[model samples]
Target: MSTMAPACGAQQPGNIPTPFDWWPFVAAPIIGGALVYVWTNGIPIINGIVGASGAALGFSTLTGGAAGAASIATLVLYYVLKADGCIRSVPKGANICFSGIVNDTTDENSTAVDILAPFAMGPAGVFDVVVKSTYWHYVTDDSFWVYCDDAGAAMLPCLVKSETACGGHIGSLVGVTVGAIGGVILGYLAAAAVGIAIGCTATGFFYLLCLIIAFIIAAIVAAVVAYAGAVIGGAAGEGIAAAANANDPVVKAWKGLSPGDIVTVQGNWVTDDSLGNNEIFYTTSINRTGNVGSPGPYTTAQADDAIPSDDCNSNSNPPPPR
Candidate 1:
């Protein structure tokens, strides 16, 4: 009787983890595989049908290859245009100026800012504006300068100095051009391979096998081409972003200052009126520069001309000096 009764205590549930916890990892591959199968099968079927029709209508393999290559080229071009900020209107009175060292220049005089025209196309429209930039080094100051213009009209003053452009040259156009050429060449080869696969499929009892083979080959090629394109496009975008960030004056100034450098920032320091006779103020003070100000960086304060006491005292008698 004493052994029959279990120890009297709060019952605890068994610590059994559920299979649902692994659903995400399991489901992702399944979903991805389904999508890949659908996409590969769908694209080839549509493309093969069109290609066969064209072939029957006297379109040679070379022409078909060229057509396929051109499609890839167009896609690359569109991506480049979009990435380069060419698909948007340039802000009024603002000239688009790009600065970077020439990664590949044919001549000695290589300093330049690759100007991009706005997206629109028409007479006097965005794309029509002949945007140009010229780089010059001032011998007297040992500084680099750039001049930007749109249709012969000057925009903002060039703020980026020349020494900063010494980094490796990389830009949207460069990446896109390289990618497009590569994509087209690869696409052409893929189309040729498909044609060969189709021709072989006409042999006896090999149609299903040939189709499967052709599909796998085509899918691999397409994936390679797409991956190359994406990489190129991403590189170009990063280059553009880098170029813009490098040209910012605040960023440049911040870069020039080193750790423990003393800097005097001149600005207003607003305080509650109850603090003293002087509330709104202007002051120059020294602080350790390099992101955060360090202690022992002597800071001085100065008061600005106060608003007339009449304006501040309209509601009630002003308090006497503390």
Candidate 2:
């Protein structure tokens, strides 16, 4: 009888993607259009239909006003729905377990190492597991949330539970708000410049020339807005990191840390365990009572003491080993 080995790919437990990344991609274009419209006609409601149309038609013959509007809308929708997230460390020779929403997969081959079962954890969210061999061969790659599934068979199903909406909202909102404002401002500036040039040129034969220049300027502006929208969307999507980090108990504890305080952390860094690389550790020591040379036992009273250096140095003081 042949024994079946565990699935090759699986997502590790405790790692999940945040939801906020989807918002900025969705909102930035809408906001940008509104801003442009308001800047042109002083009304917010018609800004999307009017400003985007004007910018689009002004720039390219192939994409008329309507096409331009559709393009912008589509672009906005694409960004809002796009998936991006940090990567997970997978140990070699171990099966990766996947839970939550699994979408697609891609292969990443590098000279440093060959990564198999790079899967996309679709929009819904994802959790992953990685297998590592004892050799500790390569550094684990940062993981990402993807939009497709079945791309890598390495992902396997795990137990299901209630899904919590974490980190996604804040990240998306910040990106969308900033991107939209930037897009609108840039769009209006481009429109204004075009309008100015048209008004300034008085040559009778220059009417066509003025129109062409205006169109060119508007196109440039629209492109700028679109680029800004994407950037904002990307930032918003990435904001999940901040959200997750903010909620971490370790980070929370570190928040109150001062210069002269001694902090002992159970430091363990993610590394390629298969390659035999040593785990990275973090430690700090402080002399709250006095200068660097003079150390204290880090009593509660010394919390307010002003230590000269922010991070503890080797010669400063040593924290208790874990």
Backbone collision count in every prediction? 0, 43
> Candidates' TM-scores?
0.27, 0.30
> Which tens-of-lDDT digit does each residue in 1-322 have in candidate 2?
1122222233244444333455557566765675465444554543554466564333232122222333454454443333222222122232211111111112222212111101111222112211111111111222221111222212211111100111332233344444444454455456555566457355767767766665555545555555444444444444444454545443333333332323222222233223222222111111122222223222222322332233323233322222
Tens digit of per-residue lDDT, candidate 1, span 277-319:
1110211121222222332221111000111121112224222
Off by over 4 Å in 1: 1-69, 82-172, 188-199, 203-223, 226-230, 233-247, 250-322
TM-score of candidate 1 on Cα atoms, chains taken together: 0.27
Q: What is the lDDT of residue 176 in candidate 1?
A: 39
lDDT, model 1, position 235: 46
Q: List the residue pairs that clash in candidate 1.
A: none
User: After TM-score superposition, what is the CA distance of residue 269 in candidate 1 from its true location, in Å?
Assistant: 30
Off by over 4 Å in 2: 1-73, 82-174, 198-203, 229-233, 236-322
